[model samples]
Target: MAQGSGGNVIAAICNLFFPGLGQLVQGRIIAALIFAIIVVGGYALWWLVIPAIIAGVFHLWSIIDAARFKASD
Candidate 1:
């Protein structure tokens, strides 16, 4: 139904704002933590442009991955 898909949409939007937030919402603690670390840690050295680009990739990947996730019943 539309309601179930709505949740996934919201999760994707959440991920758009913060890489790991959607995973956290879905109770994917480890995955969320890893994403958070990758994104945040990447920015830790803001002077390096490469890490920032990699972080951007991770951010987009998070959004797509969250949208595609289907919770098992």
Candidate 2:
């Protein structure tokens, strides 16, 4: 999908609910896995505060990344 397409919009929305879910929808398996692992791992360690903050940053990054993804021609 091209950047700024309807698919990207959908992907961004999916990421809003769960980071990396949008990447999964976009067929970016590696990116999806990385985002999911990092974000989820940080969330799992939320008691540490810093990890939770990092996870939050990654969550937003995932959403923006999904929204801006442009498939290779």
Candidate 3:
């Protein structure tokens, strides 16, 4: 709740809304895009409950990692 937070919470929220967003915010574009593609592609191709669950778990992990990350000052 102060200045110089470096978008940690923002990254977490992004990751929560969409998996891989945290990595994107961390500047890991390739990793983020790849995961995003996997999630979307899996949904379109499989349309199974397992894929959705996995994606949700991954999203939650990304968000947690983002939230725990130490922002640059």
Best by TM-score: 2
TM-score of each: 0.85, 0.97, 0.63
For every candidate in turn, the CA RMSD to the true structure comes to 2.4, 0.6, 3.9
Worst lDDT window (10 residues) for model 3?
1-10
- Per residue, candidate 3 scores C-alpha lDDT tens digits across 6-48 of 5777877888678788778877788688768767665564568
Q: Tell me how far the alpha carbon of residue 26 in candidate 1 is from the true structure, in angstroms, after superposition.
A: 1.0
Clashing pairs in 3: none
lDDT of each: 0.82, 0.97, 0.70
Candidate 1 displacement at residue 62 in angstroms: 0.5
Q: Native-vs-model 3 lDDT?
A: 0.70
- Candidate 1 to native Cα RMSD, angstroms: 2.4
lDDT of 1 by residue, 1-73 (tens): 1324887788788988888998888888898888889998887866899998898888888888788887666
Q: Write the per-residue lDDT of candidate 2 for residues 16-35, one digit (tens) a residue.
A: 99999999999999999999
In model 3, state the lDDT of residue 51: 80
